[model samples]
Target chain A: MRSQSRIAFYLLLTPLVLWLGLLIVIPHIDMLLISLRERISFGVYDRSLLQYEKALTEPLYLRTFARTAVMSILATAITLIIAFPVAYYIAKMAKGRLQQVLFLLCLIPFYVSELVRTFGWMILLRETGIVSNLLQWTGLADQPVELLYTDATMMVGLVYTSMLFMVVPLVTTLESLDDSVIEAGYDLGGNGFSVLREIIIPHAMPGIVSGCIVVFMLSLGNYLTPTMLGGKDSLWFTEMIYNQFIVRSNWELGAAFGFMLLVLSSVIVWGMLALTGRTLKETMG
Target chain B: MIPTIPTSRAFRLTYGAYVALFFLYLALPLTVVAVFAFNDSQFPSLPWDGFTWAWFFGTERPQIGVFHERGILRAVGTSAFVAGCVAVLSVAVGTTNAFLFNRYEFRGKGLLYVLMLLPLVIPGIVLGISILIFSSTLANGIWDLAQMDIQALRPGLLLVILGQFSFITTIATLVISARLQKFDRTLEEAALNLGADRLTAVRTITLPFLAPAMVGAVVVAFLMSFENFNTTLMLVGSDAPLTIAMFDRLKEGSTPLLNAVSLLLMLGSSLLALLVILFQRRP
Candidate 1:
């Protein structure tokens, strides 16, 4: 009977395993192989490391990579800074339906597609748009601003898009935190700020770190937000990979760029796990 | 609990201001989209001439003829069809996989779970491109064996469905798995001890317990597939999906029609979510 049940279990597992293997694992292996090859004309691979060498040594590619990393790191930092207070407020202060309402409001933006949200920012930040108009109306600027196609706008869109992902985990973790810990700190004669620093922040550190990692990963993989809001000059690293494949038709180079992204993201995931002292499985579980 | 400190009107006012300001920031864009949908103007962003349903109804006027572009509608239909198929397939596969994972212990179980979730963590662009390459190669090999000429298997609906199912199934599996963990095993054991086969036990005792979770998983999968832009963009054929269509239209310039679509989608999704919530609340 045990052997029969085991057979049934393996049978149930077969299709899903095959589906993932055929679509994900095998394709990833192909990408790895393609990354090692040379880019012949018309985007075909020519079985060499010529493309990888060029991608590694090219200043343009290197600069774009560094710029994307810095921008993603900054965006992650800004999101955490903004989200931490909101999560804390919701977890600690708000009660009952009000908390649910506020949390739902945070989730509403996520319900809409990212493309639409990014377009909303584009309209608001355009030269003749609301932000510029408001700045001019308030006498804060002498002229209408050109903030639309810049790193600042990209940062705004990235942070806005990723804010909910950061907040949800923080709120869940903070909700699980015992209020008595903070009360104990206070009973020990610690002030409000001191209690927050000594007790609440330490308890929430794991969530904070995981939230940052998620935001960073999403931001790094995000090509659409930067492309739409930052315009042609933005040329984010993923956008560069996109251009190589779609516009330039340089498959080998695109594969190399993709592999680099994979490696970078994997390293970030590993570093986050080490820092938080938890595996990915633990976090997801 | 710490006693509440009261009698600070200034601090309350400051907090209120901050909350209000952030709420406005969140709602401003959605408000713009909702309002412009009703504006009767040539350009989408300009002042409202009058209230009209010309964009939504597709009426023509001599001075400014109504834009009769059915591209968005067609793309919406295509996306709906693909998302529907993806939802069904993913839920079936995911539920089965979740049940298997939950009910069994085996060698390499840890590795299997990780492999299942790898697609979720990988970037969509990478997934789309890799799938494109792999599918094309597979199609070519099959064609070579058949000795028939075929167009390059670059992009199409099949690829889109396959691409979406890759990650969406994982999401369904995770959600259903969570629910399954809460299931009471003794009920199934009771059924089994009463001379029911394993299949009969599952059908009578276990499936009813899993029905609500299965519904939620299906809805989530459908929504995820519908709103998916990144993977869809990469894998879509010559025809665009609604999100892609709207994006292209925005690239040209903003229009109230886009706003019209946004309002419709928002209302639709809210209603759908409400229905699900109501269903879950049912005894």
Candidate 2:
């Protein structure tokens, strides 16, 4: 029986070991190693930081990287602001069938693929899109105003794509908070704004942090939305990474850029958790 | 719940309006996508020429429907095939990992579990590139040493499968583990003590219990795999999945046939999502 149990244990351990170890861990370590090396000649290499140096020194790369980070942060903030009230209403204010229905509505768009979602945005924002047509119909515009590719358009797409991620976590955390806690704050000479600032926000911090982390990472990593909505001028850092790896076949440089993104996201996630006094286990779990 | 903070009529009206608009914002893009599928125009966009079904059923010129477009149809098949493979593989491994986490108290388990989730945070692009670099390097090394070329290591369907499986399995495990944690272990133990072998007990009792969650995980994994663009984009070869195919076409510019495809995809995903939601509603 002991032997059987041991065998079963090994059976379970095998897949986890191979899946995480072979797929996730080793590849990342290897990417780091590859990023650190500089190819000198045929079948020869030198240990160097050339890739990192290039990423830092190149104006285009540096600008795009900074832009991606800033844009992602902005997107996260916007999504949070937008999602919080909605999540609050769903979790606390709404009741019964309406609550379930509202939550489902939030989720339905997400079930549609990102590509399709982005396409939908494209259709609505293009010169001949529904909005433009509506404008033309209202005689508000003499000509079709092209709105498909712009920074604002990209932001909208990013926020739209990320809304559900923020909402889901926010709703989960908010729903668990007792109504009396908020009521007590209100009863004790607190207004809605004050109560929310103290009681609700504090309770929802973990959800907020998790949601922000996810939205930021997603917005940061997002390739389709920005490229599609922002056009060739998108200058997204991920696009740079793709250009390096696929277009230019510069794996070393691409790996460096990839590592930079990884580190940046990790630091931001760590920063959010630390600032909120939460741990990865609590937030992620 | 009743005697909460004083809510003025104005405030309530404003809040209700906000909720209404928010739902509209959520619904509009997708609604437009679906509505345009029936728009009888060359472009997917506005000023509807008239309502028509050519996007789905037409077979000539720009009006060629998604069904008639061999490339689109083929890509859909590829996407479905990849999703199916990814779903099955991720869920199987996920179930095993769930058991590993839930049943064991091994040293470094916490660390291992954290490592398992590392994929979730790693940007899909980076994940794709890392696997691409590692596998190609490994493949090259093998070729140099053993004079053998490994096609699977190159950017292709196999790598796409591996790339998606890496992260999807984490999600699958999370979903399955949630269900497994609630499972009464004593039922399996009782079966084992009452003359049933351990395997039989697990097969008949534990698995039957886990079926709902497992099914839900499968659907989630499948949809995720299907909709996956970032990682798949990096690893895809000549045969692109539906998302990659749609992306490529969208870059060139879109036609209403793409709308047709989007409508079909939305319907399919809604059905799958409804199934999972219905399953969750079960006790």
Candidate 3:
């Protein structure tokens, strides 16, 4: 019986091992090796750090990398700020029916594709779009305002896209907080701000950290929102990676840029985890 | 619900307004997308044009409906096929992963578990390009060394499904494992002790218990695979999925037919979500 159970275990283990190893692990290692090489001639390569050097030195790539990191961080922060109160209202304020309805409403937009959502934003923000038309009708502008392609527009789209992720985690964590804890703070002469700062924030830290990590990763890696909304001047890092791989056919440089993105994003995540004193298991589980 | 602190009328009104504004923000863009699908004008944007069913049902030129657009319809079919294949593969493997993690105590389990979650943080674009490079290089190496051609390794629908599968399986495993963790081991043990063999016990007792989670995982996986853009964009070859098709069209500037497709996608996915919620409510 023990032997049989062991056999079953190994059988179950095989698929996971293959799935993770062949698909995730081996491919990444292959990418790393590819990133470490430079093309000396047609179909001939030499081991070098030229790709990394280019990524670090090229003004376009460097600025784009920094810009992407900063924008993603900003987007994460904005998403948290926007999501917190809504999550709070859902978790603590709303009654059962209202809570369910609101939660479902929160989930409705996410059911659609990101492309659709981004397109929706385009429809609302374009020069001939709804918001621009409303602005002109309201005399807010002299002529139709083109809002489709700007950093601010991109930021709004990113925040809109990532808010639900932040809200879900925040709601999960906030819902678990015992109400009496907050009541205790209030009863102990704590004002709303004090109660939130001292009790609620601490309780929601895990959710906040996890949500930030997810939102940041998503915003950093996002290709669509920035590209479509920000247009030609978007300067998104993923676009650079895309351009390298597809347009320039520089897989080696693309691999290096991709690796740098992986490493840097991981570092930021690790830093957040460390800063908040949370482990992966704690937040994820 | 009880308030943590006493709130003034002004504070209460302010909070209420904020909540209303939040929902409006969430709903407005989607509402615009759905509403504009019926717009009589050439564009998906405004001037409050008269409503028409042209984007969905019109067979006329210059206002071709989504159903009449062969490219969009074919792309939708392609997306559905890829999503279906990905859902099955992800859930099947994800179920195994859940069982592996929940049932066995093995060395390096923690490390393996962490590695499984690594895909969650990795950029989808990176996942796409890495797999592209790895597979193409392997295909090229095989061709050079053995003088044989392997088509599956190249960029295509198969690769797109594989690319989406890489991260999606992780999600499926997470969902299934959450359900499995709450399962009562004694039920399976009782079956084993009552003369049922292991396979029979799992099939009858354990499988039924996991059925809901597996089903939920399927819908989640299917939606994720369907909605996936970043990873699919890199891995897709000649055949474009719906997202890719929409993206290409949008780049060239499109009409309300795109909006029509968006509305349809929204309706389809909302129905799926409603079904999952209803399914989960069943005892």
lDDT of all predictions: 0.80, 0.91, 0.93
Query: Per-residue lDDT tens digits of candidate 3, residues B1-283?
Result: 2464678989888888999999999998999999999999988877768999999988999988988999999999999999999999999999999999999999999999998899999999999998999899889999999998999999999999999999999999999999999999999999989999999999999889999999999999999999999999999999999999999999999799998999999999999988998999999
Q: Mind giving the per-residue lDDT tens digits that candidate 2 earns over B134-253?
A: 899899999999999998888899999999999999899999999999999999989988999989998999998999989999999999999999999899998899999999898898
State how far residue A110 of model 3 sits from its true place (Å): 0.5
- Poorly placed runs, candidate 2 (over 4 Å): B1-3
Clashing residue pairs, backbone N/CA/C < 3 A, model 2: none
Each candidate structure's count of clashing pairs: 0, 0, 0
Q: Is the docking of candidate 3 incorrect, acceptable, medium or high quality?
A: medium
C-alpha lDDT (0 to 100) for residue B193 of candidate 2: 89
Fraction of reference contacts reproduced per prediction?
0.37, 0.78, 0.79
* lDDT at position B139, candidate 1: 76
Query: Ten consecutive residues with minimal summed lDDT in candidate 3 chain B?
Result: B1-10
Question: Comparing 1 and 3 by DockQ, which wins?
Answer: 3
Candidate ranking (lDDT, best to worst): 3, 2, 1
How far in Å is the alpha carbon of A236 misplaced in model 1? Answer: 1.1
